[model samples]
Target: MAFSADELRVLRRALALALHPAPLPADEVRECLQLAGSVDEAIREAGRLRAFLLADLARYRTALPGSATGYLELLQDALAAGYRPQPDDLASLRSLRHLPLAAALLARCQGIAERSVRARLARSTAGPSGAAVPAAPAPRTRLTALPGGRADIKPARPAVPGKPAPADDPAKDRPVPTPAEAFPPRKRPVPPGERREAS
Candidate 1:
């Protein structure tokens, strides 16, 4: 919010008096109150303006290609005013992506949406105290031999550092057998004697 030179001087004096904890004369007290009122009014006005801009953006978005140009301009203004792009806004932009400005804005809006999702996920994953919780370590993996000597790798849950692993866990006893190992390979009869005689 922009303040006049007179208002700025009053604000400065009020800040100084606040820090120093001094009593102000009747006139200075009145001026400080007036300045505070002005600040509150300015804040309210900004909120109203932002609301109006968003409403306008929604109206334009609903009107689609007919209001494409006006809608794009309003969306740009809304973005500049710190408005988050909605799914409808993304869809609208995607439909209008043939326009150069619309294409650029679509990319920008997609990035904003992705960042918003990531921020939301981060917030959700945060601890009660608002600190970020560390991600769990990746599962451990090991290679196990198959029937034909081919190997396959499978994930195993890492044992807790201080806790003992379960005794009944089959994975702990041995690598889990594959289907090929569960059933033996079939054998085929051979005519080796007759082939050797012909040779």
Candidate 2:
């Protein structure tokens, strides 16, 4: 349905009231829902409808301006108090806080490596003279050339137990026989009446 500019304004007002601490009377909420279509629709479309209201919030606020930012600040305070409004955020905040704790725990465990009571962290991982302990570089995989000039090595895939290969290839990708000598002929057969002696 096409909502007019006037209808949009009324819907915006109704959404704001739904979010308001001292909302409009029950009759007003129901009236807006009827205009909006239904309760399910109003709830489902709350975010969009709320955004529309927020976009034009200044216009409505100017009509009755009373420090609305105060409520937003209250929401921030609620976050600090650990009264999480969303269940999904509980794990996130806990993980965020845990990272610092992990760093501190690592710092505490530094003493276990050093026998000194002072529990000093090593400036260098090597000797007491502050010499550099070279980090062991990762090993490199040398690429050796195959029989062919190409570098890519196509290894045979590991075979499954039940299914076996159909044909035997003495040499992979090398033809069964070269073009010059693919077939060899056999001696011709003779009839019983026509013997070798008669020939």
Top candidate, metric TM-score? 1
lDDT of 1 at 102: 100
**Candidate 2: tens digits of C-alpha lDDT, residues 1-199:** 3577766777888767668856478877767767767545656686565555444433433432243344233323443433323322222223333355423423433333233423243443655667645578657989877787554545556777899854434365566686557666666988767896687
Considering only N, C-alpha and C atoms within 3 Å, which residue pairs clash in candidate 2?
none
**How well does candidate 2 match the true structure, expressed as C-alpha RMSD?**
25.1
Worst 10 residues of 2 by lDDT: 84-93
The digit string of per-residue lDDT tens for model 1 on 21-61 reads: 98779999999999999999999999999999999999999
Clashing pairs in model 1, backbone N/Cα/C closer than 3 A: none
Q: Per-residue error at 168 for model 2, in Å?
A: 59
Q: Could you tell me every candidate's TM-score relative to the true structure?
A: 0.66, 0.17
Task: Tell me the lDDT of candidate 2.
Answer: 0.50
Candidate 2: segments with Cα more than 4 A from true spot: 38-199
Output the lDDT of residue 4, model 2.
73
- The CA lDDT of each predicted structure is 0.90, 0.50
Model number with the top lDDT? 1
